[model samples]
Target: MTSIEHITLEVADPTAARTFYSTAFGLDAQVRLRASEAPTTGFRGFTLSLTVSQPSTVDSLVATALAAGATTLKPASKSLWGYGGSVQAPDGTIWKIATSAKKDTGPATRAIDEIVLLLGVADVTASKRFYVDRGLAVGKSFGSKYVEFAAESSPVKLALYKRRALAKDAGVPADGTGSHRIALGCDAPSFTDPDGFAWEAASLTPSA
Candidate 1:
């Protein structure tokens, strides 16, 4: 099955972005950066999720992000689904750090268990079909609302969500245009999805 190897975010300053990511998340290989002056505004049609083991880890990561110049979109807190919060990086990418466990299992560590890339699409059904035809396997489905793909051996998991709902979840407005300012690096051949998300064949991306 096709799997995401890493995600590349087009930023205005790759050097600063690399420093921010390294200091905040200590990410090296999983997230890559490229210099781009692409005009993008408001919500960028997607959010990267960092899933950890417990609430304390969520809090720790969030704090580190804030210290690394990430502004808070939503303060970390407990919810029905667990604990999570949204933060916008200095480069304007939204990241949601969360965990299913509401309580701390142990001491806090910045170990991220999973990285999920959620695309906000206009039509979930149509997008699902687009990916399924491209050799992606659906791991979870909830009718026309949401779908999660089984990305085997990938550093990132892929999922689809309705644009408006996704924006609300990310604590941002639904309106956005110009560029997604992001691209997915996957094992499959290059293709652009219906919503204009560009995916390319997996390749090694050096840290900026």
Candidate 2:
């Protein structure tokens, strides 16, 4: 029954990053982290997929992000996968605002229903094994193309995809440099995934 307790992202300006995410996505500001030294610069091969219940929620969130200083990577539109778009936050982290539900203009709460931390792995099959070995249960799979892990009590859903395929899906280039700038809070002993994504054990959980 493992789950992602929290996600930490390194930002040059934690205060501003926190503000942008909080205002745009209703994410708790405390999740943002400020490194004592300069953090790496460039694209991080991952995305925070905020899943909402209503179709209109996707548009609303995308609009809120842009107005709050995010750069649009993709405009809101209907797609076979769902209705949504992608954006790079003020701090350079990517986010995908989407919903699988049918189009509806009904009101939605600012709080996100699910936060999926999707990693663009060099090998999806290998990455899936890494997490499973670390205690996350397999939730769904599509061979090497995609895989999802079930979270216990944690709200964040962890998933993996082929690095290049993921970039194409998000309409962005695959090239990246320096740190991925993402971390996961889990019950497993602290370790880095094959692609260098770190997982920090939650305090309540003992080391394996």
Candidate 3:
């Protein structure tokens, strides 16, 4: 099965980004950073998500991220689907930490059950076809609005959303240009998706 073995986020300050990610969410091997001067503005067209076990864990992770210099895009709150919030990291990457369980099952452990990368695409149906041709099996989908690819043994799960809706979900404007400043480390041969997000061989990723 296809898997996203790693993810590389290009930032202006790789050193600071490394420290921030490690300190804020304790991410290292799953997410990597490399130096880049790519010109990008407004929304970068994607968001990283951390799915935890319960509401308290979501609150704890959001609080920790804020203390580590993340800016609040949305305060942690209870929603119809669950409790969650969005925060932008120091490197301008938006992260949403959330959980489906409205109540706590145990003490907050800061454990992340899954890491998801949601790409904001122009056409969900078209982009879905692109991945399907490259061996990604659709796990769940909601018409043209959303689509999730099966992750299997991968460390990171992949999903697609309309550009505008995704931006709103991240609490940002739905306009952006230049590079996505992110790359996926995958098991398949290196290729660029229809939306321009680059996917490369997992072996190219640096050690965390």
Q: TM-scores, in order shown? A: 0.97, 0.91, 0.97
What global local distance difference test value does model 1 have?
A: 0.92
lDDT preference between candidates 1 and 2, better one: 1
Candidate 3 residue-wise lDDT at 191: 90
Clashing pairs in 1: none
Clashing pairs in 3: none
For model 3, residues 1-208, the per-residue Cα lDDT tens digits are 2889899999999889999999899998899888999999989999999999999999888888999899999999999999999999999999999999888989998899999999999999999998888889999999999999988888999999999999999999999999899999988778998889998888876754
For 1-208, candidate 2 gives per-residue lDDT tens digits of: 2888778877777788878877898887225465424446555788889988777788788889999999999888888877888998888888998888767757765657888888999989888887777678898999999999876677688889888888877778898877887677666678887898877876643221
Please give the ranking of all candidate structures by lDDT, highest first, separated by commas: 3, 1, 2
Error of 2 at 182 (Å): 1.4
